[model samples]
Target: MPSQPTLAFNRDHIHPGDRLCVAISGGADSVALLLAIHAANTAPRESLGVGLSAAHVHHGIRPDTESDADLAFVEDLCIQFDIPLHIHRADIPARASQARETLEEAARTVRYDFFRSLIASGHADTILTAHTLDDQAETVLLKLLRGAWTEGLAAIHPIIHINTPNQRPGKILRPLLQTRRTEIEAYLHALNQPWRDDSTNADTTYTRNRVRHELLPQLRTFNPSIDQTLANLAELAREEESRWQAELSRVLPQLLLPGKPVRGGGRSVSTAPGHSSLSIEIERLRPLDPALRRRILRAAARQLGSRLSFDETSRLLALCGFLTLPTVAARTGASLHLANGLRADRSPREIRLYREKQSANPE
Candidate 1:
């Protein structure tokens, strides 16, 4: 039997009456989380001060035996703990094929959709997932390797607010984000509890698994505590990103003008019928520092329901004549089309970003 390990759960954001649902995948981290919460509810001193339930998403990625075993394990575990369980069966393969996404992406999408449904149905207000310190480290490394922006470096957020149109926002919490995978396994072993292992987790074909097994081990040779170091980097990035967001909130209103029809200065500009757009004055935008300019452009796109990548933002900058030495030829009347029907047109005085009208049928 493994020695008992101290399990830590961050319940600071959890409230007394909040209905909490633990997302258990029958894996070590999630299983440990469910067990720890159940134990805490039984002990007043360590209690989360909330009612607890469990949810499991069967991705159905592998053979029936493997997937069925995981579901059975989770069901039995939940029954043993006397916790109400919400089970979702996701056709991940079909979802991926239809959505043109990878199996991993599809699984994540469907799983979160189920969580949101639980929130919408009032079954739970907050969903908890077992994202460990190791996961955070892997995420940070992945982002770094991918040349991510500063915000991307802030990987594995502890709290994610899920906002649906006209509905109260729900939260997804990572209560075990600071806990290590080893610690989680130790905790389960101490209780003589078993967990199901997903075969895909060992497949190096997945980028994350490669990072976990190959890259992280290689980095450990250089620094024994690389995981903690990377996790600290993510913390720092998250704090800085929060500050940047506050700064942007203060700066955007003064610079951004709504896309509503405007007629003045001998200029007439309006989006297509039933379309919305946002425009920023070229003169005001050009004089600002490059960093602020880029952030403003991205923020404006976000408001228009689109996220601009670094290259896309840079292209927009050049289109707005902000680039001193242009890499891509950007001139007036040059319009850029982006994902989700978003279009950017550079006028004489301003650059307007709007979603182009979508046709009901296309050949």
Candidate 2:
């Protein structure tokens, strides 16, 4: 396990002033993160300064007793640390019913929604989540199983800005992103901190749990460094993506139609009409590099109103051949659709991309 001071210094880099909210689910990883941050703040590290508060969201998805136990554990820890504790109870069942969503999605949405509310209420500028290296590996593996794109394989970010409407903008900081779960457990043990173990985490019904219990163990038979390999892949992917995004941002304006807004108002990108609508011109894409062209296509599609899968991206790239003909239309010969209202086009410069109008009350 890493020394507490080392971990504390890492947290100080992510969270400087004594003004951050630590999200604690009463799990070992979160508990350890909370304790580490707290210890660092109170430690005589003149260079590192920060104050920490505990934020707990009760999803109310599990049995009442289980939910109570998690909350009780966090409350006690906060009291022991003499830090402020915020508890938010969410009606998960009702939310699931209303949204017609699974319990997992509902609970996640509610938890973050409540966290955003805390930020809006001036609780903290940044919210800390305890996502360890194991979590990152699990996420990368999950995305790989589903045939993820390069960006998807980048895994969970150390810091992400939550951009939901009507909520105060805040960042989610993962100070423990590089720390392993084993190290977290060891730290908790050394501190004599007790945490609640969620039974759902062990349930094989979830893909992540199944991967953790079944697939990982099987893979370990051949390669003991499977997790490390996956983590390294994620880091490389992240670096590549950062460079790619910067280049795209620079080139996109020249490629897009005139007077288009690049961002804002729920629109990811916007372009004005020229010869043909910006949306139609996108259908004419062919000269751009196959890799970058697909990224731009996906981004445009997402802005329009749809998401493209990895397979869809491949199909879109194949459609570029149609630009040789006078007509700018291409078809996958399947029900699979590409983003931006594209069909079959035989010309690269003539194809345009269009933004789909958002439904007034999309489900």
Report the C-alpha displacement of residue 310, candidate 2, in angstroms. 2.8
Worst 10 residues of 1 by lDDT: 260-269
Model 1 CA lDDT for position 247? 93
- What does candidate 2 score in Cα RMSD to the true structure? 6.2
The runs of at least 3 residues in candidate 1 whose Cα sits more than 4 Å from the true structure, single-residue gaps closed, are 1-5, 44-46, 164-168, 259-274, 329-343, 358-362
Model 2 TM-score, 2 decimals: 0.82
Per-residue alpha-carbon lDDT of candidate 2 for residues 1-363, written as tens digits (9 for 90 to 100): 665533431553364664688899999988888887777667776434765788998888789999998898888889988989999888888999999987878988887887788777777768888988888889899989988877889998877887545666778888887888888887777766778999889999988999999998888899988888888899899999999889878876666552222435322343433212243244435567677787776765554456787666666555555223332235433222455554323243333444434346866
lDDT of 1 at 74: 93
Clashing pairs in 1: none
* C-alpha RMSD between model 1 and the true structure: 2.9
Task: Report the lDDT tens digits of candidate 1 across residue range 16-99.
Answer: 788999999999999999888878777757566788999998888999899999999999999988999999998899999999
Candidate lDDT scores, in order, read 0.87, 0.72
